[model samples]
Target: MELKKSTQKRHQLLNAALDVFCLYGFTGASLDDIAKRSDMHKSNIFYYFSNKEALYIEVLTSVLQKWLESMQMLNVDEDPEEMLTKYIESKLEFSRLNPKASKLFALEIIQGAPYIQTILKGSIKKHFRGKVKVIAQWQTQGKIAADISPELFIMNLWSITQSYADFETQFEVLIGKTLRNRSFYQTAMKNNLQLLLHGALVK
Candidate 1:
């Protein structure tokens, strides 16, 4: 029971920190703001994280993990079209559900990813390459277009799906409704699947 409470409190702190960091980038965010957001004392943050930088990194890592998990369904064994369709749907759903985290991650990347560069170059890179390898395998198997570049395909997928989150305001303004709207979300999912699969899949 005590451990559950402790874990809950830690998650609360991380959630509050995510909101604060999204509003103000890493350097701009302060522990006091996070504490206030979490309704905890400033010193309490130290119990979970060693310092501000540590807390910031933790928040960023959590966001990245969630984003990566959405793409983990991609694999060589699955039907290419089915796997890609599910992957696109999952990415869109994540964008709708975690827009702030997505935007925060984009902000960090735009700022050169100073804090998470090592993780990006290591585990993230390895994971990304594994997905790329899956796409390449699909291409080699005549599952997708032979001319498509696996790395560029993956990069384009990220750009399209994440744009819905990173540019939520623009999307809402232009579409007159957010991705939260069921009809709009379905439209988005269908359109994205068409745009991506139509170009890559073998007809």
Candidate 2:
């Protein structure tokens, strides 16, 4: 029963950490907030993690792992268009299903990630470069537009797609409806996805 209690406590801490970090950001959030959210004591948080920064990193790592897992679910070959289409869908789906994680990630990145900058520039860089290289390979093989720079194209694509998740509140307030529920928005997504795959790459 001791081990069971330990496991439960660990899970509880993780869940609480996610909520606090997502809502308050790493710097904005306090250990008190995590403890209250998790229904555990601040001292207990220390028992599991050395500091708030460490716990925040763990939460970010967990969120990153889930995003990477989503990427791993699809084959990145055979049909570049379909492959990329599904990939975008997966990312959007994750945003809808895991908005808090998205917000946390966006917040960390927006602040320059003082605590996690090294990890972002290191392992995360390698991971992103790997994917970018794949897109470059596709461009070289005529699978994507030969004219578009893989890096710029990807940056734009991500910016456009993640806009819904990152700026939904503002976007919705302006449009008076959610981007997720609109047909025009859906078609726009389909069109933009195709725009990258269509003439941008070939005749």
Candidate 3:
């Protein structure tokens, strides 16, 4: 009862922090901004997070953890084609639903991931290596192109999927339309996914 309410309020604060951080980046965003956005006193914000950096890290990790979970969905037991299709679909959906999170993550990476470097070097790197191994296994089994480099394959996939989210404004301007509200985004991803699959599979 009491604990549940407290947890909910803390989650709310974290979400508010995410919005502020995404808009202003880590160095630009302040706890005062987060407090204003959350409609809470500055002291209340501090009660939830010891400092602005701590709040930003939590928000970033929350988004990154969701991404890692999506990646983990690509189990080795699944058919490579089906797994890849699902992975692209999931990433596209995540971008659509959480564009701000995507942009925030891109900002962090572009800035060299200063705050999250430890996590990136540790758990995130370990998890990514595991997935790369899975892809290597698939390649050996002739599930994908034998000549493809697993690292490059994953990097390309990340770039393609994340671009739709991180570059939404530029894309909308170029395409003369907004994907934020349209089913066209999903359609586009599916078409691209098919092209990738065709290229990766052995004839």
Candidate 4:
């Protein structure tokens, strides 16, 4: 289905905002930059979003929403090992395709997430709590390691998957090659992540 004109415009602004925020951090990113990237007039941006902060929050929410959707792919009824491996694959794929979103999110958290603080404390917290419940249930069913803390376990997964996007430059420089290399990603990143997750979680 085609998006409404307004919705398409909003998406354009949001995507541009994501790129700007990823490149320039919260304090440095400007409405002008977002406007230029969106190819919309600055006033048009304000028409869609009340202010820069509002636009920033919306971008953060959009990115976080995507992250949550990836996690939502997990099914408690499925074999836990398969579910976990699929989850890691989905996350890494998202990072590969949308590194800008990951960078924008990392910048927000690193700067203490001022604009997104309310969201972090509210919906984001609730989402993680629900996932934690699922993980705990899996542990009780002997599907996952009972010895691991669900919160830290999830954190570890995020760290590993997000690092691929967030630290792409470091990896490229260290390995003397871009992550665009399929074989390298399979051997050095994705496969290793799946192996480690299965090793740690499967019971």
Candidate 5:
């Protein structure tokens, strides 16, 4: 019972910390702010996480692992178009479901990832390249179109969708509506992705 309670408290603190960090960012956030947001004592917060960096890293690693699970389910055996569509849909879904996590990730990358640069350089980069290699193989085997560069294709796709989360204000202004309370934006996303894919696909 004690172990369960301890685990639950740590999870609660981490969740609250994620939100506070997303709003104020790494340099802007403090333990007191996180403790207040979490409704937990400052000492209790420290019990689970020694410092801000430890908590931030845990939140990041948790989100990164979830994102990676989503990536792993990409299903290479499916038809390339369906596979690509699923990948895009999942990306949008991740943004929708974990906006704070997404926001913090965006902020970290935007600020040059002072703390987690190694993650971006190592595991993330390796997995990303592996996906690109899969795309390249698909193209070589005529699964996807042969003309486009797999790496550039992924770069474009990531930019377009990540752009939505990273610059939500810009998206809202340009589209004249918020997608958060709206479902129509999803179809728009699908259509825009299709249009881009049309140019890249051989057919």
Candidate 6:
């Protein structure tokens, strides 16, 4: 239908925008670059977005939504080890598959998140607090260490997993292999799970 095609075209635009933004950062990226990347005329971008800022916000919002969805796997009722394992794997998988998107997000935050600060403080904060409450519930259930700070634990997990994307060049230099390799990915998942779970899981 027309709606389906419209949605598809919107997604194509967002995908192209993501690549351009990641390569050039927000200030450096231009609508012409995104249009060229999407193989559409620059004027066509206005059909879906009001302006360059609007498109950039949409692209950033989409990436953040995907990142938050990865954490939805966590459940207080599930075994802590199993849930944490799945969470770590999901995050790492996202980093591996969408490294550029991950780096773009990191760059946004590093630059003080000028465009998405409202979203970060509103929906993103609420979502993060909900997950922290889940972690606290796990601790109360004696699933993880009571002494572990839920906020800090979540922050650390995010930093470590996202580092693989935001610092891919450094990782490549040190590991001598990209995460594209199955072996490297497995090693990353295993080590991340171990490093994280070892400290938090109740003995």
Prediction 4 global C-alpha lDDT: 0.82
Candidate 5 Cα outliers beyond 4 Å, as residue runs: none
What are the RMSDs of all candidates, in order? 1.0, 2.7, 1.2, 2.1, 1.8, 1.1
Tally clashing residue pairs in candidate 5. Answer: 0
lDDT at 12, model 3: 84
- Top TM-score prediction, candidate number: 1
Candidates in order have lDDT scores of 0.91, 0.76, 0.86, 0.82, 0.79, 0.91
Give the TM-score (vs. native) of candidate 2. Answer: 0.84
In model 3, what lDDT does residue 64 have? 85
Candidate 2, residue 61: the lDDT equals 87
Higher-lDDT candidate among 2 and 5? 5
For model 2, the local distance difference test gives 0.76
lDDT of 4 by residue, 1-203 (tens): 34588889999999998888888887898888889999989999977888888888888888899888878866677777777777888788888888889888888888888888888899889889988888888888888888889898888888888887898899888886544678876775656565557656754
TM-score of each: 0.97, 0.84, 0.95, 0.91, 0.90, 0.96
Sliding window of 10 residues with minimal summed lDDT for model 4: 187-196
| Deviation of model 6 at 122, angstroms | 0.8
Ordering by lDDT: 1, 6, 3, 4, 5, 2
Stretches of model 4 off by over 4 angstroms after superposition: 1-3
lDDT of 5 by residue, 64-117 (tens): 877677666445565777777777777776776677888899899889898788
Clashing pairs in 5: none
Lowest summed lDDT window (length 10), candidate 1: 63-72
Error of 1 at 144 (Å): 0.6
For 1-203, candidate 1 gives per-residue lDDT tens digits of 99999999999999999999999998899999999999999999999999999999998899888768867899899998988888888888888999989999999999998999999999899989999999999989998899999999999998999899999999889878879898989898888999988999987
TM-score-based ranking, best first? 1, 6, 3, 4, 5, 2
- For candidate 4, the per-residue lDDT at 142 reads 87
* Residue lDDT tens for model 3, 1-203: 99998898888898888899999999999888888888888999777778888888999999989989989877778898888888988887888888899999999999999999999999899989999998998888888898988888888888888888899998888986545757777677867697667788775
